[model samples]
Target: MTVEPSVLSAVDAGVATLTLNRPKSINALDHPMVTAMDELLRGWAAERDVNAVVLVGAGERGLCAGGDIVAIHRDASALSGSNAGDDEAAACASALFWADEYRLNADIARYPKPYIAIMDGIVMGGGVGISAHANTRVVTDRTRLAMPEVGIGFVPDVGGTHLLARVPDNLGVYAGLTATHLSGADALALGLADHFVAADDLDAFLRTVGETGPADALAKYAQEPPESAVEGRRDWIRDAFAADTVAEIIERCRAVGTEEADKTAASIAAKSPTALAVTLRSLRDEKPTLAETLQREYRVSLRSLLHPDMAEGIRAQVIDKDRTPSWRHAEHRDVPTAEVDAYFAPLPDDLELTINAAPQEDSSV
Candidate 1:
């Protein structure tokens, strides 16, 4: 059997369309996929007659579930019980992949043309990286978006800290710590998405967007979204997440003594203790630009790769399909302040985040 290309592209009616073809894995983006995407977008950026670029997934389930953690799991697992010489061999596969992926994200943000992303269904982690950064983002009622990396022993990357940092009243801290899902309206209220269109009108809307243009089609089809969950609960979120530490935040959640607040506390409790500490710190930092934020995230992510939680979290969550993860610390307060601070330490020049970074030939595996 022949394998299909992970991404398929075409130009029509003054529009360039790119369809993510990996429906089986919900278009889980991998290294080659992102590399190919960067190449395509770079060419399209200057091409004539391509007034706009549109991104869509091939299937009904969603835009994308996330990155290929199975591959990252393979790379991270190799680090366990290995010698010093084995460190690069074990870790650089996924590190190289992220280097390219984050660059692609930066490109999308700076694209000259109107980059339109229709986030019609589930968009999580890496999925959010691609679409949420676009110049224009569209969502439907079926949309289910999240950045639930803390559960998997990772701090958010792909400018996730930047985006979440922009959210009002420290709600981003709550969402990041809890690994919560946001509805279409919730996303809009938090400023992650742009317009809302009914699912029934999406087919016609796309065709019109190609034939007419984004502004006119959006004006023709976009409708008022329902009430926002985030907006309704802002006071409650602010009262808790404003605290300095995750422990105090959880205490405030319990002190509130409501169903939602109690559940929010439980969700934070379930994630890796070390991950929670790092994520909170990451969100609180003041990075003036996306590039600067991404540079700092590189340090945190590199440290996470060497930690045991990433592989173990993926093992229990995806590989074994189990719900339990054996984290390094059983409670958030058990993590040391110096250990959390070390995630921000500088790396050697070779591994620094650069303008153009790719894997070594052997890293293709």
Candidate 2:
């Protein structure tokens, strides 16, 4: 019996393409996958003949679902009967998984060659980490993107807050709390994707991009994105999410009194309360560099690993297949200000990532 590499790499015509291959799991990333990707990216970065790199995923379902949360559930569960939180290195596999994962995200942002991500389908969580940071990103009608950590009792990591922070107005804040699923046009309007290529045209672009180069290939096939739903409702999104607290944001969304606005309020209302509070605070950071934001995120991620909600969330959402999760806190308002602050506290023994900030922050994705 032979096993396939989780990540498949190929170089041709001065272009290298890497495909995330776990189609059955929607190419969900695990620690091994992250390591493989890091190695492939480094090797391609040094190869003079590899002019550009394109990232794609196998299977029709999506580019990648996210990290393998079921595995995280396993690790967190093992610590359920022990004291892993007090000592993070012993907490769970999640800490180690994220440590290397965050580094890969930082490197992708700083990659020397043109990094192109073909976000052809569902892109969420870790998927967003890999693709949204790319120099060139392509989205299609099938794309369904989001950073849904709040729902899983986890704060967004993998530099999600940095990317979310740049979305115009308060859309990023709105997205963080509610885990809004973004359409192709929605991603484009929010600056997450560079070009809109029909899902069908993807094959043609893939075949020619290695030789023609992404810019020219995009020029030949890109289309005007479909109208963005989020942009249409930006008036309320900006006004509601600009508030200092989640309670205020919810109230403002209710004040809008539209069907969509009501759903938005309810969506925010249903997420893990603790996750909501911390996620909002992260998004509201005055002005942190991508590296700084990531550093802060690591603190929160390790902090989250110790919390019961992390394991319970996984149990309810993934293991038990129950839609209902009894969160640590009852609601966003119940989450304490002091507790929220602790999620961002400086790590002891300098567990903070040592990556450098991005050269210049671009507000446009």
Q: Which candidate number has the best lDDT?
A: 2
The local distance difference test score of model 2 is 0.85
lDDT of 1 at 141: 89
Tell me, what's the RMSD of every candidate? 4.9, 3.9
Model 2 root mean square deviation, Cα atoms: 3.9
TM-score of each: 0.94, 0.95
Worst 10 residues of 1 by lDDT: 356-365
lDDT of model 2, residue 218: 91
Residue-level lDDT tens digits of model 1 in 1-365: 99889999999987999888899999989988898888878777767667899999889988988899998888767763354332373248888888888888877877778889999888988899899989999998888989989988989988888899888888788778987888888888888999998888989999999879999889999999999887887998998998888888888999999998999998898888888899999899874577777778777877787788888888989999788999999877899999898788877766678754321112121
In terms of lDDT, the poorest run of 10 residues in model 2 is 356-365
Error of 2 at 8 (Å): 0.3
Q: Write the per-residue lDDT of candidate 2 for residues 175-275, one digit (tens) a residue.
A: 78889999999999988889999999999988879768888899888999889999999988998999988888999999999999999999988888888
Clashing pairs in 2: none
Give all candidates' CA lDDT scores: 0.84, 0.85
